[model samples]
Target chain A: MAGENALNFQMIEAAAGRLAGHVRETPLLNSPFIDAIAGRRVWVKAECLQHTGSFKFRGGWSAVSALEGAGGVLAYSSGNHAQGVAAAARAHGREAVIVMPEDAPAVKIANTRAYGAEVVLYDRATGDREAIGAELAEARGLTLIRPYDEPLVIAGQGTCGLEIARQAAEAGVTGGDVIVCCGGGGLTSGIALALERTAPGFRVRPAEPEGFDDVARSLASGMIQKNNALGGSICDAIVTPQPGELTFPIMQRLCGPGVAVSDEEALRAVAQAFLRLKIVVEPGGAVALASALFQGDAIEGEDVVVVVSGGNVDAGVFAEAIRTYGDAA
Target chain B: MAGENALNFQMIEAAAGRLAGHVRETPLLNSPFIDAIAGRRVWVKAECLQHTGSFKFRGGWSAVSALEGAGGVLAYSSGNHAQGVAAAARAHGREAVIVMPEDAPAVKIANTRAYGAEVVLYDRATGDREAIGAELAEARGLTLIRPYDEPLVIAGQGTCGLEIARQAAEAGVTGGDVIVCCGGGGLTSGIALALERTAPGFRVRPAEPEGFDDVARSLASGMIQKNNALGGSICDAIVTPQPGELTFPIMQRLCGPGVAVSDEEALRAVAQAFLRLKIVVEPGGAVALASALFQGDAIEGEDVVVVVSGGNVDAGVFAEAIRTYGDAA
Candidate 1:
């Protein structure tokens, strides 16, 4: 297993340097209405507007660019990471092969292919995605770019925390909890590590959908935990089976308590983001925001920061979110 | 009438200084899919993500901050400017009274009021909005903040142009057409003036909805023109009776030929922006992007920069847009 010592501020700073000019420095946004709802000053880091419509691009670029050889890369993801890796590989002039489930959103599949990646779709219920990815990597001599566990990928995601630290200061936010949507604890732990060195007063908390709260359970139990099922919930982008072995330690050492919200709450946050912030956020991407807005009792202090992680949602789901909760928000 | 000499680079620079911390420096985004659709490199300046969901906030803050006294401000707008001025006024600890038509989007009116502005509703068919605003201003000793026909407001809007020039250069765009959604020629003229000074090689082109092509006709004829109908298209934010006396001269001198697109094309751009850029762009705000994507034969360049000016769209209209064109995009 990867140790905690493998990731550090210097590595993150180096990743920041490598990722410069390639990654977008998404802004921190807030609205008075959101603040009113949260009953605090809320600052949102809009990573949803990041390249590839997610924060995964940062990690993908960091890992892909860190490679020294001319070999291609491989990854397995339900959606966001696949596109991120595809785009990053294309930018670096290296081929990418993505292993995704057949039932993945058509938008995600089309977008992945549009980025020039060869996509291999498998049945989620019967296929072993890891074995498929491993076989393809070995057969093609491609480096498997792990979504969250890799040090370089974590370091890349830490760049977003660096931005949050800087932008929060600019927005006059001294300190608060920074909530991140947790899949395999990649973004949550990466941001936690980044804040540990930069904004020491700010805490990182992982937010997950209710049925897929493996990260939250693991954090509470102080041990590795797994979800009973992986395929439920509208938040497909953040329905990982368990916390990453490499990431769990960092999250345990640095992050605050986890927050889990329902899928409906996630959709509500999506609608609120569209109505107030003029940005698109998927159900998985809005969990952190849902926790920030609705689960206020679980949080502390008068200020809070939330990262809107991604925006690779289907049109039907997005429309339903708006139709159901557009007025209430 | 406001003269062209009243607005200049120095004034825009001063406005930029005032707007440094108050306004968001929205980023320029592009997707490979968007570039493919445009048949060239396309850069979208996402002003829709600006505070108050539009670039109007920049001018609102500029005009409100430039005021010499503690008096409140008064303005009449369909929506975007009302919220902009209201937010800016509240930010400056001054009162704002907005005269809006009753038929305007409820979201805009509520947003304006939420910013602590007192909203006065008028009938679009029978009541004269300007008269109501003028009487209110006179009775309450409030300064009248014109939507576009004022030097300070124009200079404030020019700040967006300055950002476009700098951001386009950072994106490695040397020279290209910068298309803008035009209403009373405010944003168009402001961007034209700013680009003329900062990026001499870049040209500005005003884009409007099909029936509301007053600015396009005026540009072609070298004379002022007016639209016969005021309330026709779903792009209500950018529908005006005619170009501003102050703005027309700058646009006439600095802008290229105008471009007009169908409302269907604007809605398509809205759907495309939602899918590709992960940002909400209302129909009026998407016109420039629509022209940039659909009117390729009229434009000349390897690269084009288009500004999505606002995103305070109603849910029904936005849902319809997504339903109609989401698959097509």
Candidate 2:
């Protein structure tokens, strides 16, 4: 579990070069309104506007590209990652097979299919998508693209942090802290590695939903912990029971103190982003903003960067979230 | 009246240079999904993400910058224009006095003041904002910045269409048809002039909310038509009763065809934009999209551009709009 040979500046630089024409260099938006509220400077990396509506595309594209000469790819994801894999595979003229839970949102399923992937649905109660994906990969000799555990994937996600660092420098802001919403530690670990190489003086922090605090617990205990009984949360995108083995160690070594916020806080943050920044962010994407807003005192008086991880919520869910939290404010 | 020599491409070019460093060159997004729905190639000019959440800032900044060396400026508006004027004036290091209706949203008032403008509220039923603005201008010898009627303001607004043309060209798509949501004809007229100069083959069309179809009526009559009974619509931004005298002739001469859409259509378009594009566009901004979606046959098989004019809605109003149209498929 020692952070030996983990992601570093070199890997991130290579990832950027590989992803130059493949993925979008999403805008890093400075929020004067949010800054006034938090009494500190806040810049938001809007990955919500990325292709396939999330940063998952970065990792998927990077992994598929790295395995260029390999067969097609197989992945197991219920949402954004599914679309990402599908898109990345199509972009490289390779076939992608996504194992998704049958109960996944129709919009997500449609998006996955739209990216030209064949989706295999399994019952969430009794089926194991990983086993199905493994079988498929073995049968077809396709590479199993792990969502976060792979070095290539982590390097790809690091490009987001690289862009943030570059944009911040271009905007004349020297250095500060970078905050990212953690699900399986993919984005957070990648950002940490990217900042370490690009903006060495900057600190990287991970923000997680309150109920699914596996990363926080893992960091505290120095071991990955499973929270199978925690059930679903509004930030469903980050509801992983345990972090990937490859990502956990890097995250532990490079990420700053992890912070957790309530489902209500995340929902409010989504609504706040829509109201203040006129950007629609999914619940998981809003976790970083939630941490910055409700926990302002924790990282006060320093320039802060919040990673808006995605924007792919169902209209019904978005409306419900807005009604519940938008009205409360 | 024939089109006057008052507004010209040279003036708009100058305005573009003057406002270059001040305003954001908002994105012009191409959507294959929207194209499939509308049966044409559709590009959306996302002014919803513009500074102060509207295209008004372009003209506001141009007008204020033109007179910053003179003295203070006064404007009369109850909505987005007021905020834009205040922000632009403040950015130019001048004082702004805004005459707003008493019933204007508190958010608009707060936003105007946040930019350091003095907000003077008057009862819409009895008070004349124009008289108040004139008096303030006379007493202080300050320049009166009209919301849409002035030549400089029109030139400034033209910059949006200029950017649209440039973006379209950069994306390898050239002239076709451009649809702009019209209020008092400022944006449509300005955009028409810009497109005529830059993309000469491109046709400009103004889309108006049904009851306030003054632009359409004015174009048909060859004169500005006043409709005092224009009903309240969800598109509060472009619900003006009449086309501006200065804006009408230019619009009639240069704009190809005018279209009208229902408030429900506008609301649905807003929901679609939020869900599909992750951008919050106000009802007026959505009008162009609505026209495209509902009246696709009007401009069939053409490379169409829809201007998403603004994004400044109160949470309550936005929630209501979402609830009403978000599930419309």
- Winner by lDDT: 1
Candidate 1: pairs in clash: none
Candidate 1 per-residue C-alpha lDDT over A200-237 given as tens digits, one digit per residue, 9 for 90 to 100? 98999999999789988999999999999977798888
- How much of the true A–B contact set does each candidate keep? 0.68, 0.46
lDDT of 2 by residue, B200-288 (tens): 87888899888788888888887778766755787877888788888887887888778999988898888777766788888888999
Tell me the lDDT of model 1 at B121: 97
TM-score: model 1 vs. ground truth: 0.98
For model 1, state the Cα shift of residue A300 in Å: 1.2
Candidate 2 docking category?
Answer: acceptable
lDDT per residue as tens, model 1, B1-329? 44778788899999999999889999899988898999999999999889999999988999999999789999998689998999999999999999988987677788889999999999988999888988989899999999999989999999999999999999889698999999998889988899998999899999999999999999899999999998879888899999999999899899999999999999999999998899999999999999989999999899999999999888878888888887624
Segments in model 2 whose C-alpha atoms lie over 4 Å from true places: A1-18, A66-71, A220-222, A225-230, A324-329, B1-6, B30-32, B300-302, B327-329
Say which candidate scores most in TM-score.
1
